[model samples]
Target chain A: MIFSYELLAQAIVTGILIGGIFALISVGLSMIWGVMRIINFAHGEFLMIGMYIAYFLTAKAGWDPYLTIFITTPMLFLVGALIFQSTIRPILKDPSMNQIMLTLGLSLILQNLALVVFKADVLTSSTAYTRMNFMLGPVVVRGSQLIAFVGSALTAVFLYWFLQKTESGRAIRATAQNREAAALVGVNVRTTYLLAFGIGSATLGVAASLMIPFYYTSPTVGLFFGLIAYVVVVLGGLGNFIGALVAGLIIGLTESVGAAMLPGSLSRVLTYSLFVVVLLFRPQGIFGGKQQ
Target chain B: MLTVKDLKVQYGAFVALHGVSLSVTEGQVVSIVGANGAGKTTLINTISGLLRPTAGEISFEGRELARLESHTIASLGIVQVPEGRKLFPDMTVYENLLMGSYSKRAKQYRKESLEMVFHLFPRLEQRTKQLARTLSGGEQQMLAVGRAVMSKPRLMMFDEPSLGLAPLLVQSIFQTIRQLKEAGMTIMLVEQNVRQSLQISDYAYVLETGQIVLEGSGQAVLENEHTRKAYLGI
Candidate 1:
């Protein structure tokens, strides 16, 4: 295979745009994992739910996909809180194996529920700009891809600021580092756990709403993004927010360029191979995450 | 400023603390010294709301603290520097200190608090940008204390501040504790280093088998036959 500057630039641009969406998806998963000490197997299903909600809202009420954030963000936030309270909270004191199994069960239930309701059919938002693109020099960026990338970047920044600056935000950071210590410092850690989980799920919802305009959604749509998200989170470092952001972008570019250079299947294999390498060498990630 | 009456903590069928009672007056440095598994950590942990007592009453500043969350207890100004420097290893030295002051009041006076902490342990200021995990053992202990100090607690509890340090570093840490005492901070020092703990403590309690076996003025406890034999190695 031969390489040209034009092809390289286009692949890189595509990678970056895709990376933004991956960032949006992975950060929530990482945050929840960091603070709650739980791996939410249902994470991808929540994204699927968000995409479906956006699809139906647009199909029925004629609402814009971006505008659906107003409804979906808060809705998902509430749903996340409820899930934490009902499902996650009860098993929190249990062993890690129990927590993982429970969340995995919840994910299966959610995905099948979507399958039952939406009938496993692929759906997408019929936005006018879905196919629109603008050329920059010899490269071009699809409007929807740009939106997914920019939206995720902005949301990641907002979350970073919230975690660092706000009192509740500080509590989340504290809980992530030391739950008992955070509690000792007057951080309502249980409440913070619920909030972190909620925020994590909402981030997925945000990603889903953004994604529907750019990509198609099925009951199993989460499976596709889920694999990528798992890669992104592991590559970025477990529970490191900023690391996830950087890793998302890096994975995005790698996937796009790799696909362009090699067979598409080989590119995915190469992408997954990066995860294995990172885990083997730098398990802590590019940015040092939690020490243990 | 604080009182623990009839405190009993149990982990399922196993009781870690049994009817423990103690008190700390305002601006006093109280020490609780005991052997491993003697419930020193359990007592502090219960008081800090990390563990719920099966039966007990803990009151701080005239308010009941039994049902309050640990963070709520912290907000009431009862902060504990937990055993093992539980610093966020990935964070910088400065960030670890900032986490101590996560409370609203601490945030409001962060600059003043940071200055005071730096003054006490100037080494932290020099390595403010370095990752906390990279710090030496003594430096990590300083960072732990420095982090707790940022909270501006009305009563700060140190849980084995001298656990893992060199002899020289241990001496300096004890000296720092004395300085904090002179600076008028209400402190509860829990340690296995009995001799040093007794020396710095204004009042001391000896815990054995989840109960207080002895309580006295610091010197009196130091002079006790048991203290002399078991801890001071006299």
Candidate 2:
């Protein structure tokens, strides 16, 4: 119950790093929701799937977490595209509730499938960077958190460029705004949706790979991060990328500081409490008005 | 350079467009006028590739559009400004125009297209950074037209551009339509505003209950007793 500057600084710094990771993870959800107009309840399953893929690649082939990016990113992209084409895409014109149900079913299917493949047992990874740390004033920067922070920032930059500069990126944005208008303007909305899903899934893949060195993984791993990510998506605004970025970091800091201040149970309660408050006050989120 | 022949459309058991046909020669300003639910939008939707025809053929620049995709149709220089000014509400005025050329125009030309759009609608240029939803109704209509013009289409379709405009704004929009026609752009205008649409149209087609009730030169159609009494309210 005593106040300490070192503890406070440490808490804030840790929150920022974790927030970066959360931002990177939630951005895809935001982008998908913005363009496709679906909440994608199964997003957490995709994250879990990425983690397992990283685990198998590292365990079997002795690949580094970074190396797993090349493999898992593309593979997850394809997986995401397939999920859209097979299930999500078919019911795209249906009501929003139907789309939500489809993705929820997808989540269940993916979680169970991972349970069958990787089992309910927990798994983790080791890297030279995993245990490293940096000392700044009274605060410490753990290696895993640093990597997650830097990696998440880099991924966010990449996604921003992809959405703004590239033609395909613009097409995806157009599809998000007005699918019919996009079609009328010569945008292959179908392809754009497929590409957006792929890109979104690929982001999760990167997130999963980065997480292996730091966090334990199981079939339910996605549920933990996925819940945080959903909170981040709404906090940042449903489909706004920059909103997600700011919201992610803010939530990260809040959660970190909360943990330092209260017991773990109370910290979660605080986080959710903040979520409800933010929802009530500004349901659109901080950067809600901005488009992806 | 556009021809729609016997285009048929159905909504469940009800037929909206039963073998309706229209044609637009190169650089001609053709208008289609009908009352509410008279299939004007259905016809435009079919032509723009938003809706598929149950039967009939649509050909633009000699390419068969019956089975082609909507984007493909647009890339071939057939663009449509839909019934509502479907501007991306969250995007800036400039961003909406940029999205107009999103599929066809490249980055290098984006600047020029933006300039062209700005020149066409000075109001949009004045509020370039403003979100589209914040624009006035007339400005939004202008933004919609400006957005479509960014594509530089071979054939452009307008669906009720004056749907919610004031009288003065409607006159300005008609003047702009005339200017576009003078610029040698082939346009297919769909409107319920009969008098103004007929005034500027090179040719006019009157649709009644999804059928072509009258068709002729603009002057002739304006003079037609059925068209004048029912539509022009003369």
Candidate 3:
């Protein structure tokens, strides 16, 4: 096959658009990890929950996927807080093994429950913009991805402002940096934990809604997305927001470009290979040791 | 006013504070002098609601503090400039001070508090954007004190405020304490620097093995024979 500039441009555009979504997904995980110091294994399961909620809302209420975001994001927040109260908070001081087991077990339970109820068959919702496309010089961009990209940018901006400009946001960062110091400043550390986890889960709602127009939904759909999220967060340096954004884009470019050039599962091989190389060299992430 | 009666703290079977009592009247500089592991920090921490007292009564301005959490106690304007300068390591000096005003009552006075803190430590204003961890040891101590000041603290608790500073810095810190005292701030100081602490202190208590071995006016404790021989090396 001849190497064509058009194909490269196409892959780059596609990668960037999807990269925005990946960044959104990992930002939630980053906040949770930073404030709580818990690697939430069920992070992707919550995304799955978001997708399912969006799918059903579109199917049953004839709602657009975008409209479902208004419902799904807040719903996911409540879900995250409830789950924390029930499971994570009780065993917070327990050993790492207990936390891993409980979170992994929670993930398995969510997946199987969805499988039992939704029957594992793939589902998708079609909006008017689903199959639309826009041609720009040498590359064509999907309308759905453009919208998702816009949504991702807006969400990121809001999150950045929230963390920087608000009292609660300052409390979260202080708690993340030094828990005892945060208490000295009169921050309710436990409440901050709950808020961080809830906001983290809520981010998945926005991502799921954006993807529903172009992506399929199933209990197992989160498998690859979750794996990608883990890579993005690790590459961004755990708990670092800007790191996740840049790393997410890097992963998106690798996956899309690899898929365009290589066939079958070889694309994932490329992504994981990059992950390994990154881990071996600059494991602190793409930003080195820079703090947010 | 803050008062503790028969305060007892145990770490598992180990008794850290064995039935101690102390009091700080409003606008008075009260120092708790003790040797290392003599329960200075334990007593201060217990007052700040960090540790549950096994058996005790702590009242602050007529309110019970034994059932409150550390953050709640902090919100009541009982802030502590903790030992070792526990600043938020990754945050900027400005941000750390901003966090000190997170409580509602302190939040309203954020502007004035920032001004007051800056007045107390002009060096902190010079390095406002630098991260707390990057500051020199003395600067970190000043930032710690500045942060507590930003909380609009009605009662400031100092736990070894001069623990890890240079001799020069120690003089500067005690000087700052003297300034706060002039401003009529109530303080509870825990220190091993017996001479300097007692010099600025209005009232003082000497703790030995978690018990109050001596309690009197600062001049009285400073002039005592045991303090001079054991702590002051006179």
- Which model scores highest in DockQ? 3
The sequence of per-residue lDDT tens digits that candidate 3 reaches over residues B1-234 is: 999999999999999999998899999999999899999999989998889999989999999998899999999999999998889888899999999999998999999999998899999999999999999999999999999999999999999999978999999999999999999999999999999999899999999998999999999999999999989889
- The C-alpha lDDT values of all candidates are 0.86, 0.86, 0.92
Give one digit per residue, the lDDT tens place, for model 1 in A1-292.
Answer: 7888999999999999998899889999888888877878888888888888888887678988889988888888888889889989998889999988998898889888888888977876677768789998999989988988889888998998998777688778777877777777667887899899999989987887788777888999888787777778777778888888889899998889999899648988878888788888997777654432
Quick one: ranking by DockQ, best first? 3, 2, 1
Candidate 3 CAPRI level: high
Taking the tens digit of each residue's C-alpha lDDT, what string does model 2 give over A1-292? 6668888899999999999999999999999988888888888888888888888888777888778888888888988998888888889889888887888888888889888977889887777768888899878889878887898899999999988777788778878988888888778888888889889989999998888888888999888888998999999888989999998998898899988988757888888898999989987886776666
User: Where does candidate 1 stray beyond 4 Å?
Assistant: A1-9, A136-140, A257-267, A277-292
Per-residue C-alpha lDDT of model 3 across residues A185-208, encoded as one tens digit per residue = 799989999999999999999999
How much lDDT does candidate 2 score?
Answer: 0.86
Runs off by more than 4 Å, candidate 2: A1-3, B104-119, B122-127
For model 1, what is the error of residue B138's alpha carbon versus the real structure, in angstroms, after optimal superposition?
A: 2.3
Per-residue lDDT over B1-234 for candidate 1, one digit per residue giving the tens place of the 0 to 100 score: 899999999999998889999999988899999998999999888888889999989998789998988888888788888899788776678778878888877788789989999999988999999988899999999998898889988898989888878999999988988988899999999999998898888899999989899999999999999989987889
- What fraction of correct interface contacts does each candidate retain? 0.72, 0.79, 0.81
CAPRI category for model 2: medium
Between prediction 2 and prediction 3, which has the larger DockQ? Answer: 3
Clashing pairs in 1: A183-B71, A186-B71, A187-B71
Best by lDDT: 3
lDDT of 2 by residue, B1-234 (tens): 888899999988899999988889988999999899999999998888888889999988787898888888887878888878887776677777877876544334677767777777788878988888888898889988988888877788999988988899989988888888887899899999998898888999999999998999888999999987998788
